[model samples]
Every structure is written in structure tokens, then in C-alpha cells.
Target: MRIYKVGGAVRDRLLGKPVTDIDWVVVGTTTEEMLAKGFRPVGADFPVFLHPKSGEEYALARTERKSGRGYGGFTFHASPEVTLEEDLIRRDLTINAMAEDDQQNLTDPYHGQRDLEARVLRHVSPAFAEDPLRVLRVARFAARYAELGFNVAPETLELMRQLSESGELEALTAERSWKEISRALMEDQPQVFLEVLRACGALRVLMPEVDALFGVPQPEAHHPEIDTGVHTLSVLEQAARHEQPLTVRWACLLHDLGKGLTPEEEWPRHIAHEFNGLKLIKAVNERFKAPRDCQELALLVGEYHTHGHRALELKPSTLLELLQSFDVYRRPQRFEEFIAACEMDARGRKGLEQRSYPQADYLRGAATAARSVAVQPLLEKGFKGPELGEAIKRERLKALKVYKEST
Candidate 1:
């Protein structure tokens, strides 16, 4: 049997990117043969084995037939009859279909080398639609390679559209959807993925709440001609450009989803959109099966704008009390994440930068100052746990009182 390095490791190595993981396809090897040779068989649905000595995965080169539906409904064939070329032909993308021999000799059966050189994401076969998860993977690849000027093949996008219309996406579990979206949101240019989904009609299927943002009118005083959908994309683009953390980025993307739910007539006069937005964010999180921590942070982002507004109006004692109430020391990134979300929200609106909103600036400054304060030092002092807690509470109240009187 001949072992061949395949997939991302080969693609990434060719691109001079850091190769963090390696996947190998062993041709001319049967499961029983591999087992006899001391490979640990691990795959339940396919013939994948782990090298007993190297601890790296070594999958038998196999061909697949669509026997069921969605991602899990596939029958695999692994035998001496399956060639390395046949194995490479079944990959999702041409760039990922290249293989390397043990001597590091490159094999490009489908001009995958050309696609890689061209920086294009092209499907290896028309059978790519057999697996719905490939759509998400292609979207993610587009997002990652946008800066490199890579574009998905037109025919491949057409296939994605067919898959979306075929109801295959409906078979996806909430956890699987979240897994792909979470990774997409974490990309440096998430708009590429979002745009792809939008083009393929998958966004409407996978995340209708976000898709609903498109074309929903925003107040003319605050924004340009774009609706809430366009504004949301703008905010997400800004976050991606800034290299913000995943939570902050996701918050920016979903920050304005509530606007779609709000009445257009009350656009400029609405007073509780943040409150409205928080509920919507929670619903969206639960729909996507976001973890508790993600749900809480998303809710925080929805409420963040309101909190900053309150901070601006509060007196020093109340402000301090508010700060003290939150365990900012332990969850220090929380406030910064909130501020980042709010900044993107404000910047996302047109002419808001010139509008008189000193409250945003004031609260942002306060959060920054609060972060530097060593709250734990006070805790470490002779003050007992209850005393320290009470002292902090009293100090915060005093600060709020003082700020209110001064304002």
C-alpha cells in the first residue's frame, strides 16, 4: 500500500501557509489489511484508521456514493480498486483535491494546481451537491480567501443554489449549522460568507432573522439609503476590517436584527429598540443553538447600547455602582466587547458620527478606565468578603451620587 498526503495540508503547504494538521489517504489498502498492519480503525461509517506509531489519522483512499441524504447519508468504497485519482476526484474543491506521495511528489489529477495558482474555489465534481455541508465549507473558504482575491466558481455557486432549493439544508441539525456559522463569523472577512449565502439563498434558509434585515428601512436622519440589512453588513464589514474578536464581530452582525422587527414609522422616534433588540438576539441565539455563554454575550451586545446611554446619564456613584455590580475584573473582556459592539453600531449608521451623542464617548471612556482599576486589590485588602462587597457597593453609589450632582 502507498500512503499519500492529501487535502488541506497539501494545499496550505503549497500556499506557504503554516500546516497545522495532516490528513493522509492510503491507497491499495483494505481495512483488514490496515488492521493487520497495526493501524487503529476508528471510523464507524467509513474506513479511517489511526497510525499506531505516528498517532496521525490515515484514511483508506475511498470512493463514495450518495445512498441517503444530507451529509451523513453516504456509502463509501475502499478497496485495491480505488485509485489515488479516484479518491482525489471526490473532494469538494479542486484546491483540496491535490495529493502528495511519500516522496513529496505532487499529484494534480484535476488541474487543482491551476485552481490553487488562480486562487479560485472550484468544485472537484458536480457530485459536490450530494453533501450539504460542502456549501458551508465553500462559504468559509471564500471568506478566508477574499483578501487573496479568490472567487467561487460560477458553476459551483449554481450547484449550491440547487442544493439550497433541494431542501437538503433542512436536514442539517441546529448544532451543525451553528458550527459552520460560528466559524464563518470568526473569519477575517465574514461578509464573503454572508454574501455567498445570500447569493445561494441559503441565508434565508439557515438564518432568516438575519436575512430579514435586508431592505428594511432605517431612519433617514441616522443612515443613508441602505436598509437595516445593508447597515448590518456594513457593521460586520467594519468589525472584520478591525480584526475584532469573534463575539464582538457576531454582535455587530446581529446588532440591528431588531430593527427589522420594529415599525418603520417609529424609526427616528423609537426609544426602546435596544430593549427590543436584546429579545430578538436571545431568540436568534436559541434558534441557532448557541451555547449559554454565546447567548449571554449576544444579549449583552443587544443591551450594550442602552447600557452606555445609561452610563452617560448616571451620576458618579450610580456609575461606580453599576461598574462594581458587574464582575468586570473577572470578565474584563465583557465590557470591552460591549463597547466594541456599540462603536460598530454607531459607526454603522450614516451621519451618526457627526450627531451629538456624547453619551457614547463618555461611557466608552468610563469602561476603559474601569478596566484598568484593580478591583481584586481591594478584595485582597483586610476587608472581608461581605465587607468588601458592601464597601464596593457603597463606593459605587457614592460615585453615582457625586456624578449626578455635578451633571
Candidate 2:
């Protein structure tokens, strides 16, 4: 068997990036030969084996043909006769299709190295349209390599547009779709991911709420960017710039969904847009099966982010209500994430990215003051049952009032 390292490891190495995972393609190898050599069979749909000593994956060179719908619709054929060229042609991008032998020799059947040097993300073959999942994958690669000035080839984006317009993107599984989205959100240039998806018309098919935001206008007095969709992407960009967690990033992405639903007569003023956006937020969170923390933070940001932005101006009672809604006493980290998401929203506007968001500090101070209210004092003062709850609430409110006054 002739072994060659392939996919991201080779691509990243060629780009002078640190390779984290190594995948091997074994050409001229049969499943029985692999098993006899002590490789552990692990693939369910194709011929894949685990190295006996290294524990690395070794997939037999294989080719696929699109037989039906979605990404999983493809049927694979792996045999000892399968050539390395045949296997490389099936990859999603030209950058990932190159292979390297143990002797450090390069194989460039599809000109992946040439595309790499040109900083282009090109498809290996016309068969790129076969798998709807590659559309997301291509966008994600753009997010990853955007800092290096890499972009999707125009022809590749045309194919992506064709896939999106074909209605195939809707057939992808939620789990698979979420995997690419969440990864893209964490990239150094995540805004590029959403932009590429929108450019290719995939955003409308997969996330219409976000897509609808493109032409929608916001209050120019507050949002210099004007476009709700542009602001949404800027918010995600700010979250990434601050190295935020996934929950905060997810919340940032969904924070302005209500703006998309604003009436045309309202134009730039989306009064009660926060409440209008809650249902859309819930739908998106449910669609992707976001983690419970992510969902809760997103919901809180969706409904109360405006309150967070106006923390200094809000009454103590309103501030307390917001904190209580977040269960700030139970999940402090989530509350921090909520504040960060709000801060990103505030900074997302053009020319305001560097402005101070004192609202976050005020909210943090309010939470600390409320938490400082001693429950032991109330319990010792004959408080019990619902009365104890009321007593604690009253005391917390009193502390918040004093804190707000002092501030």
C-alpha cells in the first residue's frame, strides 16, 4: 500500500500553519489487507481503519457518486484498484485535495498548490455541486483563511449559488449545519462566513431571518451602518474580535432578528423590535439545536439586550427584573455573556467600535449589589415560604436602588 497524508494537514502545512490532525489515504489497499495488517476497521459507510500503533485514521482511496439528495446521498466505492487521483478528485475544495507522500514528495493532480499560492478557494471538479454541505464548508474555509487574503474563486461561488438555488441546502441535517456555523462564528474573521453565504444566496435558504435583514434599514442616528443585516454581521465581527465564547457569538448573531420584522411604515424606528424578535430567535435556536446555555443567553439577549444597553437609564426595578430574568445569581457566567453580547451590539455600529460601553460595568455592579443583599438576615427575621422570597426581593431591590443612586 502507498500511504500519503491528505486534506487539512497537508494544506495547512503548505500554508506554513501548525498542523493539528493528520489523515492518511491508502491507495492500492483492500479492507481485508488492512485488517490483516492489524488496522482496526472503524468506518460504517466506507473503508476506514485506525492505525494499530499511532491511532491515526487511514481511509482506503475511494470515489463517490451522487445517487440521491443531501450530503449523505452519495454512495462510495473503495477498492484496491482505486487510484489516488480518483480519491483526490472527490474532495470539497482544491486546497484540501492535494496529497503528500512519506518521502516529502508532493502530488497536485487538481492544482491545489497553485490555488493555495494564489490564495483562492476553488473546487476540485464540477462534482462539487453534488454535496450541498460543501457550500457551508467553502464559506467556513473563507472565514478561516480570510486573514491570509484567501477568498472563494468566483466560479466556485457560482457553483455554491447553484447549490443554494437548487434547494439542496435545505436538505442538510441540522446538526451538520450547526457544526459549520458554530465553527465559522469562532473563526478570526467570522463576518466573512456570513457575507460569503449571503453572497451565494445560501443565507436565505438556511437562515431567512438573517437574510431578510440585508435590505432592512435601522435608525441611522444609532446605527451608522444603516442596514440591519450589516449591523448584525458587524456584531458577530465584534464578538470574534473580543474573543467571545460561542454563547455570546450566537446571541450576537440573533440579537437583531426583530429589526427584520419591523413594518415598512416604521422605517428606521423599530419600537418593541426586541419583543418582536423573540419568536424568531427561539426558532433559530431550536433549528440548530443550540446548547442550553447558548439558547438561554440568546433568548435573554433577544428580549433584554436593549435594557442592557440602557442600563444606566433604567429604573432600579427594571434592572432587577432583568437580572432576575437572567437568573444572574445562579448562572453568573451566562449573565457576563449576555452583557458582552449587548456590548458587541453597541460597538457594532460604524465608528463606534472603540467607544466605551459603561452599561456593562453598571449592570455588573448592580448584579454584585443585589447578590450582596444578605438572605440570612431575612431568614433570621422570621421570613418564611413565599414571604421569604418577597423579603429577599425587597432587600435586593433596596440594595439595587442604593447602588444605582450611588452610581
In model 2, the Cα lDDT at residue 407 comes to 92
* Top candidate (lDDT): 2
Indicate the TM-score of model 1. Answer: 0.85
What lDDT score goes with residue 354 in model 2? 99
How displaced is residue 50 in candidate 1, in Å?
1.9
lDDT of 1 by residue, 258-366 (tens): 7767776776444676677777787778877887766666777775565664566666655664555445657766766777677766666654533344665566455
Which stretches of candidate 1 lie above 4 Å from their native place?
267-271, 309-330, 349-394, 401-407
lDDT of 2 by residue, 225-299 (tens): 999999999999999999999999999999889988898998989999999999999999998898888898888
Cα RMSDs, all models = 4.0, 0.9
RMSD value for candidate 2? 0.9
Evaluated against the true structure, the overall lDDT of model 1 is: 0.79
- Candidate 2 — which residues are off by over 4 angstroms? none
